[model samples]
Target chain A: MARIYNFSAGPSMLPEPVLQQAQQEMLDWRGSGMSVMEMSHRGPHFMAIAEQMKNDLIELLAVPANYRVLFLQAGASAQFAMIPQNILNGKTKACYVNTGAWSTAAIKEAGKYCEVQVAASGESTAFTTIPAYADWRVDPAAAYLHYTSNETIHGVEFNDIPDAGDLPLVCDMSSNILSRRVDIGHYGLIYAGAQKNMGPSGVTVVIVRDDLVGLEAKNTPAVFSYAQQAKADSMLNTPATYNWYLLGLTLQWLKGEGGVVAIEQRNIRKANKLYQAIDDSSLYRNPVDPACRSRMNVPFVLADATLDKAFLEQAEQQGLSTLAGHRSVGGMRASIYNAMPEAGVEALIEFMAEFERTH
Target chain B: MARIYNFSAGPSMLPEPVLQQAQQEMLDWRGSGMSVMEMSHRGPHFMAIAEQMKNDLIELLAVPANYRVLFLQAGASAQFAMIPQNILNGKTKACYVNTGAWSTAAIKEAGKYCEVQVAASGESTAFTTIPAYADWRVDPAAAYLHYTSNETIHGVEFNDIPDAGDLPLVCDMSSNILSRRVDIGHYGLIYAGAQKNMGPSGVTVVIVRDDLVGLEAKNTPAVFSYAQQAKADSMLNTPATYNWYLLGLTLQWLKGEGGVVAIEQRNIRKANKLYQAIDDSSLYRNPVDPACRSRMNVPFVLADATLDKAFLEQAEQQGLSTLAGHRSVGGMRASIYNAMPEAGVEALIEFMAEFERTH
Candidate 1:
């Protein structure tokens, strides 16, 4: 069976190899006589899988020795509350840069625990661009400065880390994590929901600097406490064992495919090809500023809005799927995460051109 | 490949049929051209799977119309905090029945959010027996009376729901949910981590009565708020797509196995046969009171403690694996959840008899 190019923003595609490996081992993982799903998290087999997953992620990202890596659950949405809970310490206020839907979500959850101050926002531009860092009114006294590295909905990406100086820099990299090389040292904390580039939709990864670990707001749920999870080696309770192992397989695949550096180059090429095709087209338009457009999620509108339905219906008939935009907004979105090959991007471009010529 | 009689508690085992079905659908789900892992949670396919899963669970549990079903993440551990966060509405205190490890955890997390009153505890008897509800110091003024339906670590099960007349009855049925039929109308809320008696680890199920749904405490994380989750149909974030689909398969398998009533009969036979074997043995002992013994996780100690390692090793050689008891209190634990067939339990009994005779 031919697999279609899956472009869903998240719960997106995993490498075919990863899915195959998981399928082959669905009943017995490495002859353990039990499915990975049935293995105890504290058992040696799962523990090894968990350890290897952490080590590989650390190696891939070159995470500093002082950072604590945790495989958590709930998702990045939980991190919206957890980051402020764990990082706010004694500070009653935090600074945020709002770029799009996700950044807005972070601000909303952060408001639950502390005074969230938006240092800058792109709402004035309908989330079409990120405000220049020079224009950001960052507060040095705030607990930390938070930003979403890539806004999945608006298709805005931060090309460079925004400077937070003395305040810790926290980022929501859910849509773009591991798609590119990152300097882990620049952020006090980093988190991503594993549905996108990581693996599937169960495990959530959090990388928190050591010094930023212990402090938690009163009444922080134990599941949301980095210090508690770190102390327990993230086995604060039963983990999503199967998802963890699937993620491990994805990490292994990523490494076998030449690690994050090679993946980043491929991601750049795929994004460039798609963006170039859109820019050259008379029938399609992307509203986000080119300088800050996401290399992960590309939202574009058909020149004739009336043709949108027919375009999507035909795309599916031709084995391209999930290219529809997030329902909150109206245009079409193509999310080419790490697992999406440049060939998929090329196919999408070819489809666009053919559909336009025929019209 | 021949499968083993896996006895690991929690993340323990799944029905052979469920595993086989999942393997068959691992790459492409029903000609969808993508793994369920790659599907968007909001898409029609996954939405149907989610709806079917909920219906099966409701039919199997006889869930009342006034109750709401939610698929959540993190785990039962997250519910330890969330239960109080959502249930403690205007009430300054809550009642708890502490039976074992999970019960103790619930009390601890609840303490973080409210004034917890231990109505009854098994600590006086080393958690080997459930205290009678008549002996409980239950407070009618408390918002809720919470308990673990089965103490997984202690091999104790509350044979009857504890009486909590005016107060809401909240239960954590993580290890035993769906193993037996439950009267949903009796419970204000019931939660289970879906690793045992359901499908795999990752997704959690919460069944909450309508009137008890909306009262989230201030600062409750949106991800932890059942009202918000129930409102959004639990897509407040990406639901654990693959795990969610796997659970759907398990529910389908459960229904095909004649639903919970039939499974409960099988479970009863399996538990009785094993318990009788242990009770009849000169070289084994089970500490939990027979009146409230668990039908799911049966913890036993060898008459000769020195032979524990030999037993586990030989059991592995015999394709009887993970029989070692929980480390906190160890000798042997044979978790015979619904997935554990009666034949497997008989095999364990035969193994116990043969080993006793040989030693």
Candidate 2:
């Protein structure tokens, strides 16, 4: 089966092996005489899959023993309200670093339940760079300091982990998670949308320090309450069983490919090659500063915007599909996630060069 | 490929055709050279699927022009909170009819946001029957009157839509939806977890009257807010895309089988045969009142309680799997959803008869 190099931001490309294995097992998962989608969540079979997926995530992230890994349904967008509702504890205030669309969204949602202090912002820079750490107005008495590790729309990333002092650091690592290695112990809570680096769009993987598991704010829905979900093993409701099992396959694939550290190195090489190619080209340009440009989602605009449609159509014909940028930030975004092979990136670079010459 | 009849309560059986279709498209969906899992939710390919799904549902349910259909993520448990947060509007109190576990859960979550008035409850009957409309004590001043149409665990169903007078009737049709025909116009809102008779978990279909769309209580997260979801065409977030696509397949299969009216007839026959078999047996009996017994989930207890383990084991061996009842209410539950062929029901009856006679 010939496949295209998908760069559609998310619900984007998945590991081909994962998809093939899932197809093979779609009719009957592991000789259970039923698809994973057909199993009862409380059944022993589903329980095993759930346990294995959780453990793999723990090992891949090298999650501390004090941290709890949860596979919650819905995307990180749900976490916007859930975070303040769960982690605020007794504090009526929280600090947010507005990096781009994702962080700004969180700040807006948090404003509903608490006093949100804009600790730092890259809005002044047109989201081309991250706000310097020292410029952040840290609220020492706040419940937590939140930021987006990677701004998907703006193509801005924070390579350096900002210190929140004694306060817990909550990070929305949606677009860039599992693409590189990071210290899991540094964050009180970390959430990544599965559609990006993980699996599909059905689940969100949340890794939260055990201390953040309890102490929920009042009137919080049980489904959104971190304490409740952790206690229930993230099975407070029937999960997206098909999505969860498929995620397990991806995690297994990640392990087979020599774990996260090995993948991170490959990712760095791919990102550098694509960025260098774009930098050398007069017909294409990436707006973000080199130091903090996202490795996962690289948004580059054509020198002439009129060529956007032709470029996308030609890319599609070349089996390079879904290269459209997000409407919020009009340009072309190639979300070369972990599933994207380095060959795909090389192909993209070559195609860009050819297209640039013709244009 | 040989398939077994899966009797799981939810995350239950899907039409084999849907599974086969999904498997065929896993590698390359309609020559798009990408799996549905890899499709962009906002792109034409996925948007077409999403659009088809919404239209199919509208046609099948005979949804009124005044009602809006929304596909949202995270299962119906999330809706337990969302419903109260959105529908309570300006009212501080809402009336709820408690028939079983699902209703109880909804009540608990609703209490977090508003005063839940238990208009009627069948807990006194051990949740074996739906409270009669005459016995209801609904508050006339309530924002809406809510009830669970089918109790998954209790094996009780309201065969008739309860009279709520001028008040908007809200129904949680998780188990029984689309298995039977109901007047969509009667409900202000109808939410069902797409697991049982629908498709899979992760996506919850919410059908609400258009007039009820904008009245969200303060601090309602956009993901849960009906107005926001409606405005965004249910793309408030990425949504459970794979789950949504699979649901569309199930809806198509339903149409192929002649829509909800035809399925309701088949469900009625299936339920009758199983109930009759139990009623005729000396060693088995269904606890629910015959009038209120669920057509989808039929729970029965063996006369010899100690034989439960042996019954389950032998049934599994014979390929009648997952007939074990919910943990909350133990025994045997044969959730013969729409996908379960009449032949499977005959096989189950034969197995039950044989098992009972052997003991």
Candidate 3:
């Protein structure tokens, strides 16, 4: 296989060890004579895997005992709709902090279920900075205060977790989950699509405070109800078994690499290295506020407008793939999730420096 | 590795060739140096796979030029809600035939969006047989007539297609899809979960007539809107890529094995062999009516109730697994979808005969 470093936003890189383990077990998982995909969700083999996955996630994230962790299907976008359906409770109003594209989408989906209050926005700075806490106008009676911890598109992140006081604080941690430590008790719900720092795209991790169950509107579909899904152990319907297994392997990989705290240090170092390259060079620039630069996704722009395509093409040739930015926010984005090894980021920086010298 | 045959209802068995290919491609798919799971949905590598999957499904189903094919996440159960949201078209009544567990779920979901009318039912006979078309009470003004072609739980199938004339016909073909060829023009819509006869459980294949588009209720989430999904080529949201690839590979395998027509013949033979064993023995009986006996799922009961646990345990020892029946209907169910080679069925029959002799 050719040497390659994947930098795609998501459905991104996974730990090599996890992939290797999964490959070895593809046909016969743990001598069960069947792939994980071939086992029934209700079967003992799969039940064990499901239980281990839940247990590992709780340990990795330090999720509170009072919070129910759900292994859901649809991606973060699906949670965009689910959050409101489950939490709105006919409150008709919720506070939203728009950091970038994903939070905007969550807000839009939530709009269908409730009146959204824009608590704060960084749109004035082209979504490159987190809105200051002082500017946030949170409604005390709102159902919940929602935010995106890491904006994959804008490369902006919250330096300090927002305070919701007595209100529920919900965070879409899709891109940054497991890359660092978090206080589980601070938020009522934290959801992340598995593709980024977790595992794959099909399974989503939802950590919801136990008291939030049974809060869904009567009109909510059974599939969308947290209470119903939790009751069924995320198996009210068939789940993506292979994906779930792959995620479990990923959790095992995380544990082997000294868990989230250790991985978080590596993530911090990787982010610092890439940001330093951009900061030191006049050829490249990241627009995010230094205090709030995202450690997971780093979106940057070229000093020369014409260098964008050339930079991506040369990067691809050098084995750096998916360096192109999201079209909604054009230039470049390197999503250095937990799976992105330190070497890959260093190589990227080295390549960026060389490219700058040549250009 | 110990040789074992997986008899799961879904997230079920896959072609050995597909599994091998997937394992081989785990690190780099088509030289992209990324597993299909690791690629972005919008990237060239994944786009090609998505388009190819759609085209292969179209060709396999003989889908008409006017019909749209969509690859969606959320299993067949999700479509239960989507069907009504997209096709209801302000129509209050829709006709449904409750053949088994799947159909019952479909009817329940449809009830959420419309006034549902049961056109016919097999409940009177414990869901062992499909009701005759002449017995149907379909509403002429109903937006569509819906039915499940095969019930995974009851081992009942619709041997004959129903004619609805101008009234659109919809079938949840989850368990029996790709098991046989059918005229595409017969139904207005057909959707199947990938786990049974297709590949895995994460993705669903939806074939919608062109005319069915543009009629969705505004309240429907964009993810549920078939029109939106079709327009986006099923990339409106992140899809289950590995499952999609598996389905594509399974489709290729089916075609290589002479397509659904030849497979149907094999399926018929296999179903006959199992049914024949049940018929020849006073020791065992399949409660489903012979005419409606499903070629895919065969639910059978031993005349001696005490033999149930022994049957499952001994069968497992003999390389047969998941012979236990659904909890709702107490009996053994062997879901012998297209992927279950004739040898597997023959082995099952032989085991059943031997067990009967001993017990």
| Candidate 3 lDDT over residue span B1-359, tens digit each | 67576677876778888889988998888788788888988899988998888788888888889998888877888888888888989889999999988889989878877899999989899897788888889889999999998999898888878988679999999888888778878989999888888887788889999999989987677777888888888878888888888889999899899998999999999999989998999888988888888988888888888889999999999889998988988879888888788889999989988988888
Regions more than 4 Å wrong, model 1: none
| Local distance difference test scores for all models | 0.90, 0.90, 0.88
Candidate 1, residues A86-144, lDDT tens digits: the string is 98898899999999999999999999989999999999999998898899998888999
The sequence of per-residue lDDT tens digits that candidate 2 reaches over residues B114-163 is: 89899999999999887778889988899999999999899999888888
lDDT of 3 by residue, A94-159 (tens): 999998888889888888888999999988888877877888999998999999999888888776
The residue-level lDDT of candidate 2 at B183 comes to 94
**Candidate 1 lDDT tens digits, B266-306:** 99999999999989989999999899899999999998899
Compare candidates 1 and 2 on DockQ and give the better one: 1
List of chain B TM-scores, one per candidate: 0.98, 0.98, 0.98
Least accurate stretch of 10 residues (summed lDDT) in model 1 chain B? Answer: B1-10
Best by DockQ: 1
By lDDT, rank the candidates, best first: 2, 1, 3
- Candidate 1 TM-score over all chains jointly: 0.99
